[model samples]
Target chain A: MTTLCCGGCSWPIPVESWNREEGVRCPVCGEKIVALVFPAIARARSGAQPEGLVSETEASCFYHPGSRAVVPCDECGRFLCSLCEIEIDGRRLCPKCFENSLASNRLEAAETQRTMYDTIALALATFPLLLFWPAIIGAPAALYTVVRRWRAPLSILPRTRIRFYLAALFAAAELAGAGFILRAILRLPRVQ
Target chain B: MAKNKSIYRKLTPRRRGIGGFSQLWLASDHILLVRSSRFVEQYRRFALADIQAIVVTPLADHTPWQLAALGASIVWTLVFLVVDSTAGKIFFGATGAIAIGFSMADIALGRRCRCYLHTAVTRELLTPVSRLRSARAFLERIRPAIEAAQGTLSFDQIAAIAPAVTATPADAPPEVPQAPGYLPEALFGLFLVNAVFVLLMQRFPNELDNVLPTTFFGEFVILIFALARRGVRDPRRLVYALMVIALLFMSWDAVGLARSFTHYMGSVMEQSRRGRPAPPSLTGWVAFEHAPAVLAAGWRMVAGVAGLVAAWFERPVKTA
Candidate 1:
């Protein structure tokens, strides 16, 4: 039997093992306790072949040609041994492919940071309305923003194009209003 | 399921006095306290991991204040009846009924003592184990469970582990329970009552000569009791200090009530001798003898403001 520690406080729990269904309380911190059950890490030496390497007639590891190849890399199609093969999401990959895929995000394992143009466009078109003086400058800036990022990728989740449309409409309205104001200002001296 | 059943255990409550209306159920991860009274049935859960401390304080006895309020209200009703004022009768009767109702609530809802499950963010009342003996028993049953749940780690070790896990907001640990807003509620009620009493005193001085002190003293006792209850429920230094200040103010007012009344009567007699028409009905008398009623009002304002500040500091739990 292995000793169970609290998830909250890491206090040594006296219980034999955690029950999967419900959680317990940490006597020390009083946090709700749930056990994280994982297999013990193996202490065996790395790259130690269980059996003798295959001869020239049989398949050999791409990285270690003297060792036998167990699986092929899913991405690069290179032969890999037990030590050289990295398993992720049920797919085996060679060390170089694994390292490269993670670094370059070729595997699409995670999403990178992206600019949210729709948000920027919306902010440009609306925030300037607070200080009426900036509306003249903001109208053109908002218009330019929408046009530049029109074809850019949106958020990872599903969303409609309503925000883009709204931004464009507001920007157009501001520009028209600015024109109307300019025309009215020019006519004011003649009327007086 | 069998393993689940084995993990789930029942906590032995220290006290069992809700006429068998309260129960404690312990699952692998949480302890649930189910309390059912005639008016309400409340279920409270304490996560095993989040519990920082468990404490039981001595049971509260609200009898002295409850009886005081009851007596004063009854007296006020009699005085109103003797005066044959229909509005006065109704008003005083309502006050008396309210006082009785609160007393009854105190009897039904008030526990002998307070037992609480403490965490960093919240202090939860354990109604079942309110008695000293029962709370002890409850502690006995839950101690091993908590120790077992936690295994072994010091407070510092837990603190060190918290930052490592907060890299992803999605993976962030659950928010701790918030403190219940009972203290604020109590403080607000006390302040409101004081305000109303002050307004009434300003409007009707002669009629409320006896009434004001009686009701003020009565309400003071009740509010003090409420403050004491809150202190026991959640021990905080600020709350304790506020309670002490309120007590001192109340004592000062109680002692001065007799002298103020005597002075008021003396002034009224002197005005009669001089053949003055009498004080204006438009506004209550501001000065009662040599001592100004403004002094008493000032004291009340101080206390009310203090209560408000205390209430402000006592934050309630957020519910989503």
Candidate 2:
């Protein structure tokens, strides 16, 4: 069952009080927010164990030798009892395989933290340019970063490497300016 | 042994850390918010049965800030290239990076608004999870436990009894529509636009005269009218609104001061390195840059103090 909570405070909104579609003021915070309710099916319990294990009479679970095996894990092909069996995206997986799949993010729906290198590179290349002085060092740093992270994983959402290109271009410009300044400084004594 | 194990499992709240390093524990009967700093540890508990509502506020749009940061970085990078001072370039570069970093964080971060757990009597804050997906998942994990402890088939029983009206889509989840953002967000956006315009004008010495009018009007518009809008009808809301506006102005000015002050100090240091005595006349710049910030901070503090006083006076009405 889906629980609807007050938007102003996390208290469970009384189901009876909520209409199918309407705004309601949270009694606790007095903030108005809309609540929409929908139907849902219950998920079968993952940790349920078998009633009994029969030796020799039935194919037993790999983890629970006594409990009858319900299905074979799609990935590892291990026989699993009701407790060990996990169905994900229409594929039956044993507990260990399911966990591994989650860790590896083989399943697209798995939640995983990803490092955004493009943003970091852009920030590194751009911020130091603001003061005019840091860019001498920052430009090179940014260039190096762009090159290093060119193949790095980006945000989960689709993003282009336009930031990377921009960062590289700015860094190159900073480097060119720095070179020009160094040449002018060197030529000052020659003119003297 | 079995009883002890069951008691342990039921009593222990499912613990998880949210985006801001804040921890939340969902127990069999209550939710616990745990916040710890160097000096203090604070824990607040809201009983599951007592939780009257949960609010998910929508995140304010930050696209403008991201665009602004990106534009500023590119412009400053070119400016830094033209400027001969190495120290200045590096300083501005770092500052620009930080600005962009903040903007990016704001843009990339989850969109979940502040989540509050409200009881029958008082409202409590939960460590706001940034992503709606994460927040919803957290709620799903805790809902069954809360319902079981309450001993009422308040939520789940409805699914069983309520007809699965085929016309109603099977996968549709209930959602809370976003409320309008805080008024101060619009005010702050306006104030920042005005401030940026004035600062850009002040970049040139001859354009300095235009700065005063712009700054004056901007301040009056943001500070004066913000306070004026509340009017006299609801004194409590007026005080609250004033308090919020003051705090926003204070923080905004403080960040500006910090950035400007760093740049100013860097220029001074660069001059000293060139063996030239720092010009005393530049002292005017110090006051010019910082006076408003100091004033805003003072006003914010005063408003905060006054808010406490107002709250004291408001006790009777609140209870009533």
Candidate 3:
């Protein structure tokens, strides 16, 4: 199923030989296969570095990668890749830090779940209401969700800030709409 | 295979809604599994396992369209209650608006998500291949609840724990009957119809605008209400979801409004001391230029959504 691509045409080299891990070799170009899905992907077939592509070796884990782990610890944010990874409490941790961190607390997961639930609930609420009453209520709910997640200790932030972004944007729209309505209603002349 | 914790962090996050907003990711397992926006946003690792099912039901099941319509009705109802001039016309306009918005919502429901759900769930069912009957039976196990939500189980006499009401998004409208939806060109047909409808209903002549308190075209958006409940194959859940969103938005608006009034009053008193009479309303104190159109649009969206939810109760269910 795999075919090496040609460097000159950028098409797959004939289906006789292709490796996604190694990338396609260009028969006409005589360069290392760097066309589509090829080997030596770290270095181009021409052996030139592309502008944005970075070699995996050069990229350092925020923590120590030499400690023999593939994954970063979920708590301390250490770069403990697969082999060095371990379970601490219920979450994944680096082997060296797992038992030690286990003694600290288990509040992280519960708090993360709580905030996530609140945010999804509120974002869903914000969209339907931004036209209804969002100008007033949307901002506060969005803010509360943001503050709850952002203010938490770095060790335990909700893994994502997506809800806050969604809620905040829609809440702003809702509030603006409400303001517009209030303005229009009051401007009409009274019967007396 | 051990779970790769590092895979969670060393990740690039992006979203694509190729078909009705379902997201997918390049997982470490080298497969693209469809995911929830919230879940993908939260856990960097795409947990392909969580997807239980994917069903490609057409416009027959969406829910947001109804909520949008409901939003419109509520807005008009408030306006009629306050404006005090054209009661019958306003009521007629508002009720019609509610209906159209909800119907649109219903149509939008089956537009996309059912297919996504069916695809995702069936993929899981196929991993073992032998689990097809089990999977179908499992879904059937929840069939009554799903049917009750969809309002398909009439003879069972068992009612949904949730009562049917206006525009609750969780109520599962009955499934769209199985029809082969292949007309690759049908999308073009829909686009043409949509353009004509918008022109005829929404962008009518000013004479049309003059006759109605609001433009007749204003009623067109009610279509969105039916779209929101597509995920709910049952009536109860659809209603419950709609109720939650509608109530949440209304209460939120009510409280904020009271505060804005006070803010307006304080600004007025400050302006009045210079010998000008205070206007009875905030229009003078605040801005009125774009309020009505904006408010109407917002209402229209919510009303359409709410109506779609309400209409799910009227859907026909399969008798299996």
lDDT per model, in order?
0.59, 0.57, 0.38
lDDT of 1 by residue, B1-320 (tens): 11111333567533345443566768666786656442233446566766655544443356776677767666755655654568877787787777767666555544455555655456566666654455556766776677676554444543444443323223334545636446544554565566566566666765655556566766666666666466334634565566567667666766576555456656777887999866654233332332435555665666667667765665454577
Please provide TM-scores, in order, for all candidate models, with all chains considered together: 0.36, 0.41, 0.23
- lDDT minimum window of 10 residues, candidate 1 chain A: A36-45
Model 2 / residue B63 / CA error / Å: 24
Off by over 4 Å in 1: A1-17, A20-26, A29-52, A56-67, A83-106, A112-115, A136-145, A190-192, B1-320
Segments of candidate 2 deviating more than 4 angstroms? A1-3, A9-12, A24-33, A41-57, A87-92, A98-108, B1-320
Give the alpha carbon lDDT tens digit for every residue of B1-320 in model 3: 22213222211123244422222223323223323444222212212222322221112322554566566665655555545458665786677677667666444433331112221113221111112233233333333333333333221221221122122323334545543221212222332333333233334433232322232222222212222323334333443444445445444443544455557777787779887888764343321113433443354355445545453454444467
DockQ of each: 0.01, 0.04, 0.02
Identify the leading candidate in terms of lDDT. 1
Please give, as one word, the docking class of candidate 2: incorrect
Better of 1 and 2 by TM-score: 2
Please identify which of the two predictions, 1 or 3, would achieve the higher TM-score against the true structure: 1
* Model 1 alpha-carbon miss at residue B143, Å: 28
DockQ for candidate 3, please give it: 0.02
Model 1 chain B: which ten-residue window has the lowest total lDDT?
A: B1-10
Sort by TM-score, top down from the best: 2, 1, 3
